[model samples]
Target: MRYGLAWCMSTFGGPIGQALGLTLAEGAYAPVAWMLLGACWIAALVSFLDGRRRRRLLASQTGLGSLRAVDWRQFEMLVSEAFRRQGYTVRETGLDGSDGGIDLILQRDGATTLVQCKQWRSQLVDVRLVREMYGLLVHHQADAVKIVAIGNYTADARRFVHGKPIELICGDALLAMVRESQAAGTVSKQTRRRA
Candidate 1:
């Protein structure tokens, strides 16, 4: 019963599930339940594939102009997908809202790295943001902290991160990562096709 409730909630939700909960258990409506579940799964697959396509499109574009053009959410998604391709287990934190705090938690080789995505257009990432991330790093005891920006970092920001377990990725550096991740995805797809 609990599992049925969970499935109904996930597949239909709210009033629809409430109305169908009894029907779902009825022998006559078993086909209806299966059909609705199949539809839900298909929608999920399409949504996942579409998001992958959008991430690939974002990665294939060259230069910071393309990066800055995406909204804050898409920018974060692009960064998350890139790191995932680069072998990190990425978790989107959605902490401190959409535009601030640790936006991603990356795990690789038993080490956890917290990431902050800054999609600033004209301004450089300043020391204040770096300092805050450092504080988070210490508090969370993460292996490292990374700040990914569409623009460059300020001199103070650069100085603060030097010799620390913090990596600042911006401008050309970020573009290189995008390109590398994009290429990695392509190679894997080709390999799978050939296999």
Candidate 2:
């Protein structure tokens, strides 16, 4: 998915670019040659600009909230839009007790995924949320359970997801998905309707 691609690009590409800069600095090529070579890097800049433009288009269409005014329901809607943009058939159930701990159910390629959204602004998510989601996965017989915390997770919470069937998506990860979905030009119809 584009979200995964963007994460990989930012993580790996940063180090690669730094190494390339070091290599260029130590090379036999003169300053003039380096300057000429630097001009070729304009392509990368253009690509980045194009991506930014596409993200702006998506933001315009989705009408996402800024950090200053994001509400819980809006955060949930954003998560739903993110999944839908990734080609999943998403069904949001809101805060219902029947679904156990699952907040949203998504289906794609015959696989059912349960999602839990936490829209905390300051508090760190704890392990209880992860454990509850694991139990809900069993109750729902879902293929996977994803816990999306719109804030940082505590150390224990992160450890709980490691080596478990449940996946933890932190605030940064969710934001990255939204940004990537925007860049990919895959805004969800739900978002458009809400707008």
Candidate 3:
């Protein structure tokens, strides 16, 4: 249960009521004063109840652990789409245990890039995955190796890719880029509409 929004609304309601009451008190006749106060209270009550109900519904739909596990294949598709938008020809290699840790092989501008997709829950990606991809890149003579973790990354994992040409896309960063792309499309539509 997330009560933070409810708590803030309750806390702020007191000061808001006081300010509104004081303002209304200074105004006109008895009927108008009563009506204004009643309307304010009703609006506040409706808003609070609506917020509570919405929160409850959202919580029920998406439980606390809902974000923990995501399908790796779906994530692979998302990454492929992301790369495609960047003008790369992406290929899904499935699980190649012998081919090292390469899960996706991408080609662009005659340069081949190896990508490993890890769809984890709250687990932090460690340095070992990075090392494995680095070995695969060298073995396959790939121009670049990318390790995209669809979750958080450990400090060591970040440090491991710091100097290397390896790219790391955490869950939040990936989502942000997707949002940016969506927003760009929306803006383009609006511009065309204005024209």
Using all chains and alpha carbons, the TM-scores for the candidates as numbered come to: 0.77, 0.60, 0.56
Of 1 and 2, the candidate ranking higher by lDDT: 1
Candidate No. with top TM-score: 1
lDDT of 3 by residue, 33-54 (tens): 4777899999999979854543
CA RMSD (A), model 2: 18.4
Cα lDDT, all candidates = 0.84, 0.71, 0.66
Q: Would you list the clashing residue pairs of candidate 1? A: none
Pitting candidate 1 against candidate 2, the one with the higher TM-score is 1
Q: What is the total number of backbone clashes in candidate 1?
A: 0
**lDDT of each residue in 92-142, candidate 1, tens digit only:** 886337634889999999999999998898898999999999999999999
The list of candidate 1 runs beyond 4 A from truth reads 1-36, 39-43, 95-100
Of the candidates numbered 1 and 3, which has the greater lDDT value? 1
Q: Give candidate 3's root-mean-square deviation (CA, Å).
A: 20.5
Count: clashes, candidate 3: 0
Over the stretch 1-195, how does candidate 2's per-residue lDDT look in tens digits? 224434444456687745545554555336646676688798789968854653443475333235315666656666776787789998889844454566799999999999988878779889887888888888878899888876788899888878778888876677777777766554454667789
